[model samples]
Target: MNVDQIILQSVIAHRLDTIAQEMGAALERSSRSPIFAEACDFACGVCDHKGELVSQLNGIPILAAAGSFSVQAVLEKYTGNIQEGDVFIVNDPYRGGNHLPDIGIITPVFHQGELVFFTVSRAHHGDIGGSVAGSYNTRATEIFQEGIRIPPIKLAVKNSIIDEVLDLITYNTRNPQMLKSDLYAQIGANKIGQDRLRTLLDKYGLKKVKESIIQLLQQAEDLTKAEISKFPAGSYTGEEWLDDDGFQETPVKIKAEVTYEVNQVTIDFTGSDKQVTGFVNSSLVTTKSAAYIALLWTLSPEIPRNSGAFRPIKIIAPPGTVVNPAESAPVTLSTLHCASEIISAIFKACAKAVPEKIPAGFGRYCGPSFYGIDPRNQKFYVGFAFCCLGSGGGKKEQDGFPYMAPISNYGGVRAPNNEANEVQYPLLTLNHHLEVDTAGAGEYRGAPGIKYQVQFYGPDPSIVMFGDGMKIAPYGLGGGKEGSLNRNQLFTKESGNEWLKSKTAPRSLQPGDILTLFSSGGGGWGNPFKRNPQLVYEDYKNGYISRESALKEYGVVLTTKGIDWNETKKYRGIDYESRYNV
Candidate 1:
């Protein structure tokens, strides 16, 4: 291509990306729920008339990829009926959706009376008519018990809202006002994207704009292929285990074998365990989304994300497996823990090919769901709190960030603020802080986890805990120590304190009762003795590690006069390497 054409294509690509970003901004600003506005658990993107992703905003990568599948479903079902000013919504897991709560809205745009493109928005509703208030039923054995499942249906037609369809959705949710407002926000964002795309079409004309999009997609494909070709062709395998399926004591295994060939990479879950009778089974959509997230992280950031970029990557998980469960399997909790395990397995497999590029294991969701009637207002409240805790594994030169979302969602979901929690619900925060000696010991130490206690202030509330890494701690690499295990407890005024089951069924919490959670830390990298002593002293002075742990774990000696250089040398000894086989 000539320089002028190349410049034009770049401009068009930037415009498309800008439109997606604006859609996300609209959703965040207009949504009513803290999960969407504060936690930012939403995604926006644009696709061609053929339902191929062209550009996407920065949010949850897993949710962003859902747009293509959702759009394709709508187009196929409503082939000749699609018209301007029409919007369709879908959240059926069997119909190209992650789960029931993550509803997606698709709106098509036409240029000069011809179908051209589509704009899509997706967000997680806090509650969607489930047996449990929080829509995370740990004991649910089927999808029907999880929540309402909406197939692809028209939400608006000819620029007019469909009151019947809207009412049906709102009536099924616990918080109708919040759900209605969020749905409108999603629709409003798509309208904004529609207008922007039309403006671009007007400026560049249909033919030229279409040509630019084709060229842009090709550029992304070429860039991604070049990056994939850099890895040496080989087969690598990784395995991970879940504590339980919330129904049995036996652990469930997830095994992944990644094969890299010339300019292509394929991940197969053929050896994964069979589907379980719990809510942890993952659907095909969630499995593919998790694999996409893993590959996206491995590729260079310069490569533009579009359908073309994924053409060279393949994911396979046989039907009835935990990773690709049957349609009847409950999958409400799939994306939370199972998705993280999938990503962890992929990273473990890739470590053999590119050790420096992968970090150690990070903790997944280890939080509580509280739902009850507030005596003060006589109103019901449901809260899902996935609070901050430990850091991820250390990188080649830097330590993983602590208290961030797991690799699956990354920074898209934020932990609720302590002050906000007290004001929004009938609860009181007793204590919240970082736990010391919880980080995995290595050359670069893993991030430490958190400890927090909450007490019920009003009537008794129902509480359910969801997470993993309780029995098996986050794994460490290169001889690093494993991170601490997750712990949960109940402190009742009548019965004293007792350990609560990791994946506990919902139960009542009397007033004045306290719940405590200790989230797991991230895995560490390399050997602990190789860590810098000065950094160890800093960790000691900052109270992240005790002097006793320092002495035993890193062979460091400390006194009132600070670090004892001679004593430290003697503690480490000259033959430390040979003694420990470091």
Candidate 2:
């Protein structure tokens, strides 16, 4: 903590940040999937030799969480003397990694031939070997069907690729070139971090760097405890549901009970549903990461995420449950679906303890429904690019984001106009717009979802719609209203063909047949009766809500020109007592 120590620490921290940026740039430049380069679906980090996270890139949150487990896996497997050029790779959830697509590369940093720390990068590839075209199989029953599962293995030694390992990866994946290039990009990112660490050590010396790491850890631990001290020591429980497991078409529940003690918090998932025969089961590590997402967001949004930030928190999810599934359960889509419920549960728990800081429930899943077809013509044209719409936001001091990507707190980049699915694939664009009245209705209104219509341009083909948020309506908070449900269908204008009564459509889509996707909106905050009349009128003018529906949902009657204030007063009857149940 002396002046010289402070200066050395500052320089080392700066170098760590630079390493993260370099890793991100390498992935962005070399990755093939738009999900990685465009959406930034990747993460990189540095960890102590003991496998504790030291520094990480400001990349995707879930991907960043997996970095800790990846390091631990590599360290546990490598028992021999450390080397200057050893690198490891892992992508199996049972082995404490993320899904197969989120392949992680780890490289150990050495100074004077002594192991000091580890540099790691994880990127979500577009495809891993799976039963479906893309690794995202909506109907996958087991982990074996999802893709190749790589236990801790040495993918690279020093600066060269392990040819046998590379060959194994390429042989398993349908898109070998893309996966191979992205894998190398991750490896290269780690190398940049290694070089930067060496330079810092050479200048500041290894002892100072290690001492600075100790200080950083202490600071993070102190901040987490201070944040938790603000909340009263108590237990809070909340439950949310998934529309259905891939096998069954009925909603499954996930429950969380968070207990706050004197400087510590424990999130227990004992009441969650049993594992199902689908890809929605989550690993213990992924479940812990998802829980941390909500706790970190509420306690201290400004806090840096590393091992220390999690010192004051403990997460427990029983085996065989959706939140924390058994080792054998399929977890390919666990983070995509079950993780959302975990976030919602955390939000619900924090809202009870700190109502002002937490917002009401937002729309949970703005699904990127993945589909594809392989014909005799060219390379497989798969479709996993979907947009956000209709999910509600929490009622913070202000309104929540409409159709926003919740939990992960990310957004989708719209593809170019000419790049329609029909132009490239054997698909036709139908209806693509906002779905009206799909949002949760309340004093603070949740955002509404978007609608899209799809038709086949060629022969009958199969399409998979991996969707959620239908059965469990995004619940409202503190007197807020519940959001609307999701919908999907197959329509045909020629034969007056309309959608069949089904929650999800898994049938083959024939030529001349139409498919409609209805995204759900978020719920509203507070009682609708207290909503501002002028705001209701503005919504009518803005085409968000019709004049009649506004009067019905918000208790605000609108005149020909605008909202009728006097008539609204006549209809205003806020039943906050029953609505909030506080």
Candidate 3:
């Protein structure tokens, strides 16, 4: 293509991405739930008529369906019957969704009386009714117990809202008003995408606009392939494990074998273990999304995030494995647990292949779900107290960030404000801070872990501990050490401060009960002894690490007179204390 054509294509791509971002803005600003509004757990995208992902906003990477299975399900169910004003919804893991808690809303865009694009807004609702209030079911072995599974179905037709569908879904969840409002917010968000796409079509004409999109997809594919061609052509393997749900003797594994060709890569999960009785089983979409996320993170940022860009990467997720469970298997924990493992395993696999691009393992999700009646307004509340947010592993270029959520989304999800959470629910935040010496030590240290505590004063809310990254800590790369583990405890007069499982059913709580969470720290990158003594002293000075840790873990001696360079040099086994400009 000529310069003019390339310029036009770039403009069109920017507009498409902006449209998706506007949808997310609408969803977050207009939604009722803190999970969607404050934490930003949802993502928006635009797909082509053929259900191929065209453009997606950089939201939650875990929600990287990007019109793959989700859009295909809608097309297959309502292909010939789709109308301009129709809207579809789905949450069935087997059909297209990553799990039951994540509900996807699809809106078709018609231009010049032809199906041209579809807008999607996928969000994780706080309460999608299951056997319990919060959707994370620990003892669940079947899909039915996880939540109400909604297949691809019309939530709206011919621009008319279907009250029945809205009513049905809202009725199942505990907080109907919040769920209903959030659903409408999602629907409205998709409408923005549809409107934006139509406006773009009107301005550029459908023919030119569609042609530009096609060219953009091709350009993405070319750029991605070109980047992959630079990697060493060989097979590499890596694996990560999830904490057992007390039912198993050992942890669950999520492994990956990556094979790199001249211009393509393939990730195989054949050696992974079969589906377990726990809810951590991964759906195929979650597994594929993880593979795609891992590749996208390693690739050039200039590469557009669309389905075409991911064409060079193929995932062979064998059925019945933890990476790709069979139909009807419980997958409520897949997004947080096994999905994170999948990304880490791929990163580990490519450690030798692309050590510069690969970072160490990240601390997984340890947030617990709680639901109860708030005495403030006589309203029911459901929330995943995100104050228990963890850390991200270190990289060659940068240290991991503290208070990071799960590695699946890579902090696409935010930590809800403590003040806002307190006002929203009947809870009082006591403490939420980083603990000293909790970070994995290396040349680049991992983000430190958090110690969060909260007290509930509501009319007896029930809290369920449901997540991973406890039994096995985040693994480091390039000789870096592993990070810390997660721990949860419930303190009440009756229970007298008892420990809680990472995965379990909801337990009733009394008023004035306190909950404490110790989120895991991230893994490190490179050798710790090689780390700069100055940086170590700074960490010690800032109170991010203890003096003993700086001496023992990082081999840097510190005193009131600052670091003793000669002692540090002797400890690091290096001749010189040369300062390297980072």
Candidate 4:
């Protein structure tokens, strides 16, 4: 390529990024759900006519990566050729992406009446019609119960809305008004991206813009391969367990076998448990999107993530397994539950290959927990409330971020205020704070857990809590102790009532019933004995750990002002086991 070609490619790439940002801003401004506007639980990307990702917003990582496939699925399934002003929408987990709640819309851009590019936007609506209020039932046995599935259909064609499709969606969902408004917001975002892409194509010519996408993809592929080659040429295997499959009381396993050869790496999920009769089953596209993100984080954190970064990596998951279930399998909580285990296994594989480069495992999975119900007004009000929890940190790094949403990191940034929650639903969020001493102890302590309380104002009979990770805690790295397990409890103003049975049972709540959620903390990294005394003292002073627990778990002696290093070492070195053989 000549100098002019390089310059033109760079300019086009920058313009596409700008287009993505504009689409994202429009979505945020127009969305009715706080998760989209405040939490930014959405993604916007520009794609070539072939449905390859060109650029994306810096919003939710997993959403941005997985949403690309939704657009491509539409392009492949549509019978008629895509023309200018053509728009398509789909949310079928079996056909394309994660679940039915995340609706995606694709618009084909035109330059001089020629189809030049496409723009796609996806957002998680508040509710999709299902057996459960939140559309995600922890104990759901089949996909039919999850939500309404919509295949590729023209939401808007030539700027004219499709009334039939809109009517079908509205009829199926409990919140038709909110869904309709959010659907238009998604369409509006895609339109903004389409306009921006057309403007860029007109200035640079379609040939140059297309050439830039190819160049951009090639650059990402090269950088990714270079990073993979740096690791040792070998295969590594790791496994993690969910507390139970919501049906059986025993633990179920998910395993990963990662092979790093030449410039490419493949993750094979064999020996994983058969797909459970629950929402734990993850779709193949969702699995690959997660693995790709973890590999990028481990190998090339700075490289732009588009279609290019994944050209060198392959993901293999046998059908019927947990990672790649059949089309009928349910996957509403893939982001919260199964996806975390997949990422944890991949990161563990990378840590084994490059220990210094990787930190120990932070508690990867949390917040498939759903808590809420439908008020008498027929207005669907629900909450995926336990999303705020810390992850276990690696040795070199502090415990993973506290109350941070795993895989996506969408929950941590400024949360929706209590007033917003009250305004939207008939529920009151009384408390949302960090759980004390939830982080496991080590040289580098894990992040603390989160605690939240929700009280229902109106009569809503069914409220489910899909909390997992009870029996098997989030494991630690480098000989560190595993983090604490999660806890869920029910309290009421009335004198006595037996607690609901297990993680799967839906709580039948009265108007004044109060629910408390204690999210688990991440595990520590390295030996606690080696943790700096000053840091230990700081932890106690900062209210992260109690003084007594620190002395017992970390063997640090607390003085009036801070830790006494010499005294701490003397007590830490003492073998209490020798004195008391109990």
Order of candidate numbers by lDDT, starting with the best: 3, 1, 4, 2
- Clashing residue pairs found in predicted model 1: 391-402
lDDT per residue, candidate 2, 1-582, as tens digits? 788878877777777877888878887777766666665678889898888887888776777866889888877778574567777889999885877777888899889978888998987777788776667766677788888999989877776778998999878987787678778788888888888888888987878788899888777888888888888789998887887776787878888898988799999989888988877788877888888888888787766788898888898878778877777678877666787778888888778878767666655553443444545475655555445344546475555566555455334322323144455556667667667666666677777777766667655565566657766677887787787766666566455555433223345665667766676777678777677666667767766777667977888788787655556657875443354342
Q: Kindly indicate the candidate among 1 and 3 with the higher lDDT.
A: 3
lDDT of 3 by residue, 1-582 (tens): 899988888899999989999999999999988998888999899999988899887888889544567999988888799987899999998898989989999998998889999899899999898898888888888899988999999999889889999899889888889888998999999988898898999998998899998998888899999988878889999877788754686988778899989889899988898888888898898888888888777777788878888889988988788878778988998888888888888888888778878887788788678888889899888888787888989999799998888888788988878999988989899989998888999888899999999999999899888888778999999988899999888899876989887886778999999999999899989999988888898899888899999999988889899987778878877765346432
Task: Quote each prediction's TM-score.
Answer: 0.96, 0.90, 0.98, 0.92
- Residue 559 lDDT in candidate 4: 75
Q: Rank the candidates by TM-score, best first.
A: 3, 1, 4, 2
Model 4 RMSD in Å is: 4.2
Q: Is candidate 2 or candidate 3 better by TM-score?
A: 3
The weakest ten consecutive residues by lDDT in model 1 span 573-582
Q: Against the correct fold, how does model 4 do in TM-score?
A: 0.92
lDDT of each: 0.85, 0.73, 0.87, 0.74
Write model 1 residue lDDT over 280-375, tens digit each, in one string.
888888888888778767767888878888788898899999999888789987777688888888988988788878788886667778889888
Q: Who is ahead in lDDT, 2 or 3?
A: 3
Identify the runs in model 1 with alpha carbons over 4 angstroms from their true place.
388-390, 573-582
Maximum-lDDT candidate: 3
TM-score of 3: 0.98
Provide backbone clash counts, one per model: 1, 14, 0, 8
